[model samples]
Target: MKNNATLCFPAFLIGTLATLFGGEIVSAAIYSITNTTLTVRYDDATQTFSVTETATGQTFLIGGKLEGEAVKATVTGRTIIVTQADGSTASLELRENVPFVFVHKTLRNAGTTTTYIQRVVPLTFTLDLRQPAAEPRTMGTAGLTAPDRRPQHRPDHQQANQAVCSSAG
Candidate 1:
């Protein structure tokens, strides 16, 4: 019984350690661009990635097994590299506070040369957190409605007449 217990303890410890830190750590974020919402995820260990468009429900896999070939992903500091099975590669460098979309395309007439460009764009993000809801407020007593606050538009002739009158005065 003592020998069996000792054998099981090492296995249990190894299993526990693997469970604690074994696979790649994945981080994901949802970014909004114009009318599209994209969810992108990066695997820290493998450096492979995928992006899903929420509107179309389409997913694109990059340098992963899902591409029907084994690919290797590596990260050195802020730079990530993904080497495809065909010896092709893609890379991305992390930038501070800058939102960008990686556009990958094959160069026309370039014979298998592919290019990856980072296009910086504005993004909006929302976080889900528990917070106290605010009570709705009633309209103020100032009698200012939505239309009253809007700028009034004048005709071109009226503006011209006002300008002439002001200049004359």
Candidate 2:
């Protein structure tokens, strides 16, 4: 038989909320955190983000832009660690669930006849105070497309500047 013991009021309490997202995210955020760490749970898989604090008792939740470019992100327990100088770190699992989004849009110029496209991709999620995170792969597969045949223009110049266009017909 399972021990049904809560005879007295417990001191440690954990709070949580159901996460919802719109705009550009279409995935669930399943991440966790502890006093010294933050964790992510996904389809039976697990990852942990790490954090170190000199103080205790007071819970905390921090958010920052995650830069996982040209690399695979791996989270083991509840705190994420960096290896060297360029490494950036953030903490989770203390105050409230957090949500973040990073959008990536891609445009393909096939055939080369039509030349103009613009794109915008958005990813969003709620960070659970404990074991809260969405799989990077779960990021919305969304985007906007705009193409410019003026490939000869500077990378920045390639961007359309309607403000500078003349209206002559």
Candidate 3:
């Protein structure tokens, strides 16, 4: 529901990659969309993103590298459709009151001949755990020495698990 998110990083390395589509990579403008708990910013030129925790003002970036170019991005309702230069598409959907954003990506063959994609890394998170607000929390438990030490954002494990599982499906 918040709309004041900005794009600035203090702990990341930004680098550009050569174009993969055999055409000039256009530097598109940056844009953002928010869910209930996080604000996500995307650089269309690099096809990279940064996530900011809405409550804590903590920001995490795609560490040290960039991806392919995004030719277009369309925001429809709570979903963002991004079209890459290689004919692939990635859709980012944000649900109301949900902290997690679901991503669905489709890879396509841009060229006339058949090609193979060896590896695809959506993004790499470089977390700054040194910050006091970035300290990890052991949810649904009082002590860290518990038998099952699961790092969860929500206080209830059942709800957290359900939220993650359902959203991922």
What pairs collide in candidate 3?
none
Task: Report how far off residue 42 is in candidate 2 (Å).
Answer: 12
Cα-based TM-score, every candidate: 0.26, 0.19, 0.52
Candidate 1 clashes between residue pairs 3 or more apart in a chain or in different chains: none
- Report the number of the highest-TM-score candidate: 3
* lDDT for 135 (candidate 1): 29
- Give the per-residue lDDT digits (tens) of candidate 2, residues 33-84: 3442222222111122222232443233233232232122223343322121
Best by lDDT: 3
**For model 1, how many clashes?**
0
lDDT of 2: 0.26
Writing each residue's lDDT as its tens digit, candidate 3 over 1-169 gives 2211112112221111233455855456555677667766666665666667778877754442334456787677666667778666666666668777666656555334434343455435665555564356643455653324554454554443331101111
RMSD of 2: 21.8
Q: In model 2, where do residues sit more than 4 Å from their true spots? A: 1-26, 35-61, 68-75, 79-169
Whose TM-score is higher: candidate 1's or candidate 2's? 1
lDDT of 2 at 72: 22
